[model samples]
Target: MSQPMIDPFGREVSYLRVSVTDRCDFRCVYCMAEDMTFLPKREVLTLEELDRLCSAFVDKGVRKLRLTGGEPLVRKNIMSLIRNLSRHLDSGKLEELTITTNGSQLARFADELAECGVRRLNVSMDTMDAAKFKTITRWGDLGKVMDGLRAATEAGLSIKINMVALKGVNEHEIVPMMRWCHDNGYDLTLIETMPLGEIDEDRTDQYLPLSLVRARIAEDFTLTDIPYKTGGPARYVEVKETGGRLGFITPMTHNFCESCNRVRVTCTGMLYMCLGQDDSADLRAALRASESNDLLYDAIDEAIGRKPKGHDFIIDRRTRQPAVSRHMSVTGG
Candidate 1:
C-alpha cells in the first residue's frame, strides 16, 4: 500500500477538489464578474490528464475526491469522467466520490450520476424566491433547480444544499430555507460569504456572519451539537425539535485552517494550498514534462511544505482591506 499524503503541518491531506472546467452556466453575482473570461479549450486539462492526475493522488493515499467546477456538469461528457473515477471506489482506492454543482443541469443527469456510482451531491441554492434566485444567479431558473433537486432525491442521491448567506440578499430566507430542508429531509449548510473575488457588488456590504445566522435559528429551535465526520470543514448540529441537521461553514469568523485536510487543483492544473491565500504550485508544467509521477509527487510535497500556517482573512482594522482578492469561481468554490 502507498503512504498517506501528509502535509508539513501533519494534517493528512486525503481530500482532493478538482476543477474540471472554468466555464459556468449561471453568472452568480458573488461568484463571477460581468465581463468574465474563460480559459481556452487548449488551456484546460483534458479528461485523460485529469484521470492521470487523480490517479497519482490516489496512489499517494488520497481517498476522497470531489469534482468541482465552473459547474462540473457543464464539461462535455462529464458522466464518462464520473464513470472513470468510480473505478477508484471499485478498487477500494477511494472512500467516496462526491460532486458540487449549481443544479442547473442536474435534472437530466441525476439518474445517470447515480448509475455511475456518484451517491452524494452538494447543490448551490441560495434562495427559494423565484425573483431573488434569478437576481442572485444573474440568470437562473428556480423551477429548473427545484426539479433537479427532486430528481436527485428520487435517484437516491444524498443531497445537501449549500446556501451562501449574504446580508441583504438571502439572509431573510435562512429560516425558511432551513424549514424547507427539514421538511424535505435534506441536509442544509449555510456558508459565510468569503472575500474571494471581485464581484459586481461590494462583498463587504453583502457579507453575512454565520454567528448571526445561528442566532436567528436558535429563536425557533434548540440546536444540539452533533458528532459527524464528512471530511469537510462544516460544523454539524441537530435541530432539537425537527431532527434535521444544519451545517455551518464559518471561514471568516472561525478559521478552520488548523484542521484543513484538502488541496485544490484548478482547471489549468494549479494546486492551491489554501483557498484564502494565493499560495499555489503549477502542476501543469510538471505533468506535461515528466514521464513519471515522481516529479508531480515531489512538486505536491514541496507545495504542502510551504502551505501557510493559516489564511490571513481578517479585515485589517486600520486599512479596512480584505486579504484575498481572487474570484471564488476560479478557486473551485
Candidate 2:
C-alpha cells in the first residue's frame, strides 16, 4: 500500500513541506505587507488534520517532512503536531522531521522540539545589525531571536542561518553574516530573492543575483564545491578558511528544477506541486469529503501527475509584478 508519488518528469516526490499557519510575528519587507489579512481560524486546518495529511504523504513515499509557516513556531499547539508526526521518525518511515522558523519562538520550544525528534532547524536571520534587522523584519527583535538561537543550540539542534541577498539592502552584511554564522558554529545559506507575492517595494530594486554574491565571496574566502543537499534546492560548498559549509539557493541566477522532488501544502490543505506555480489541488475538500483517505491519496496522485517540468520565474522591470502573486509564506517557503 506504499504508493510512490512520482511526477510526469519521473521525479519521485520524497519531500513534503507543509505550512502549519500563515501567521507570523514579524512583517519582513520582502515577505509581507505591514497590514495583512490572515485566514480565519476555521479556514485553517487543525493540528490533527496536519498530522493526518503529513502521515498520508509519508505513506506515499515522502521520506522527509518539513513544517514551515509565516513562522511555524507561531502556530498554536504546533508542538503537538510535531510530536504526533514524530511517530513516523520513530517507525523509521520518515528520515527527518524538521521545522523552518524565524527564531521568534525557538526559546520557548527548543527542548520540546529536541524531544520530539527534530535534529535540524533553518532560521531566517537576514542581518546581524540590530537597526538593519529591525528595518528588514519591521517588528522583529534581534535580542529575542538571538536568545532563541542560543536556546536551540543548547538544545542540540543543528541550525542553519538563511539570509536573503537583497541588492542595496543588507548586501554589505553578507560576508559579516557568513563570518558570524561560522563563528557561532552554524552553516550559512545565501538565497537569491525570489519574485513571490506583491510587497510594498518593487522587486526589481530588491532582487540581488547570487552570482555577484559568489564573486564577492570568492574575493574574501576560498570555497570548494561539495556534494551536499538537504532535500531542498540549495547547492553547497565548503568554506576552506572557516572550515564550515555554505549553501546557495539560486532560483534566479540558476535553476535546479530538474532535480526538484518536493511539493508544498498550505495551512488550508492546498497542495502545490510546483512552488513558483499557482496551480494547486484541494486536499481539504477531499479530506472533508470523506473520513477515509482514498480521495486524499487520489487527489495527491493527480496533482503530482500534472507537475510542471519547471517554474517560470522572471523578475521583469517593466511589469514589476511578482512571478507568483501569492507570498512565499503562503506557499510554505
Candidate 3:
C-alpha cells in the first residue's frame, strides 16, 4: 500500500515563500494604516532559524524560494542570509532564489545580492510621477527607488517591474510605465489586488483587474503569447522585441489554483497552505524545540493537506467562502 501523507492539513508541500522581516521602510497605503501594528521583534524568526527552515523543506520538495517581507532588503543581514541559502540549499531542488522588494534600498545591496545567489529581482514601482509616488508611498521618494533599480540592473540581476494596478492612482500611468520598461529591456508584470490579511481595505476598489488592464495596454502595443516556461503564475507576452516582455497575473480575475504549487512561510515561521485561509503549521516552535525531521516533516505534511481545493473568491454558480486576508503584501501577493 502507498504511504499516506501526514501534514497539518496532510499533503506534500512545495514552493516556500519566506518572509524575512515584518518591517518595511516604505509605507504604501495598501499595506498599512496609520493605526496598523508593526510586526513586533519577538515574533520574527532569526536568520539561523530561517536558514534551518529552508534546509528542512528542501528535502521534502520545496523547489522555489522567494525572499519577501514588508520589504526584505530592510532586514539587517540579508546578504548573509542570501549567501547562506546559496551555499546550503540544493540548487537542484530549490530552482528559483528570488526576492520582491519595494526598491528603496536595493541599490545598496544589488550587486551583493547578485553575488550571493539571487538571479531575478522584482521591484514594486507603480508610478513614475514624483508627486503621485510620494502620495502613494506616504512620504517615500521615487528617486531612491530609481537609483536602486539602476544599481540592481547594472549589477546583472534579471529585473522585472511589479506594478500594482490601483485605479485612479497608477492605472493611467500604466502605458508610460510599460513602454519605459519595454524599451529598457525589463519585464513588466501588472498585478491585481487581492483582499487578503494585512491589506488596508479602504482602497480595495482601486484594484484594476487584469483583463481590463491588459486591454488598456493592448490599445497601444500588440502582444503575442510567450510560450509556457516553468508554468509559474504569470502568463507572458512580448512587445515585438524592444527586448522586454509583458506578464500578467490575474489572481482576482482568473484563479490559477490547478497549477498552484506555492506554500507560504510568514516572518513568524508558520507554514501557510493558502493566502486567504489561515490554516498553518508552526515551524518556528518546532525549530525552537530542537525537533527532529519527523516533526518537521509532519509540519510540512499538515500545512500541505490544508491547501484548499482552490482560492475561489467568485460567487457564480456555487457558494463562495470569504478570502483569507484583508491585504496582499503580508501574504506576498
TM-score of 3: 0.89
- The Cα RMSD of model 1 versus the native structure comes to 1.5
lDDT minimum window of 10 residues, candidate 1: 314-323
Q: Order the candidate numbers by TM-score, best to worst.
A: 2, 1, 3
Show the lowest summed lDDT stretch of 10 residues, model 2: 315-324
Better of 1 and 3 by TM-score: 1
Model 2, position 260: C-alpha lDDT score: 98
Ranking by lDDT: 2, 1, 3
Q: List the residue pairs that clash in candidate 2.
A: none
lDDT (Cα) of model 3: 0.74
Which residue runs does candidate 1 get wrong by more than 4 Å?
A: 315-322
Tens digit per residue, CA lDDT, model 3, 1-333: 112333343344456788888777777876665455666778988898888887777766666778898789889887888898886444576777889899999879998888877888888888999999988788588999999988998998988898888877888888888889987778898887665554444445566778997887778777888874433578888877354688888877877666667777888887777775777789888778765656666766656666775674542224222365434545554
Best by lDDT: 2
Runs with alpha carbons beyond 4 Å of true place in candidate 2: none
TM-score: model 2 vs. ground truth: 0.99
Clashes of 1: 1
Over 146-192, each residue of candidate 2 has an lDDT whose tens digit, in order, gives: 99999999999999999999989999999888888999999999998
Candidate 1 per-residue lDDT, tens place, 56-142, comes to 889888888999998999999888888998999999989999999999999999999998788999999999999999999987899
**lDDT for residue 75 in candidate 3, whole number 0-100:** 91
Q: Evaluate residue 237 in candidate 2 and report its C-alpha lDDT on the 0 to 100 scale.
A: 95
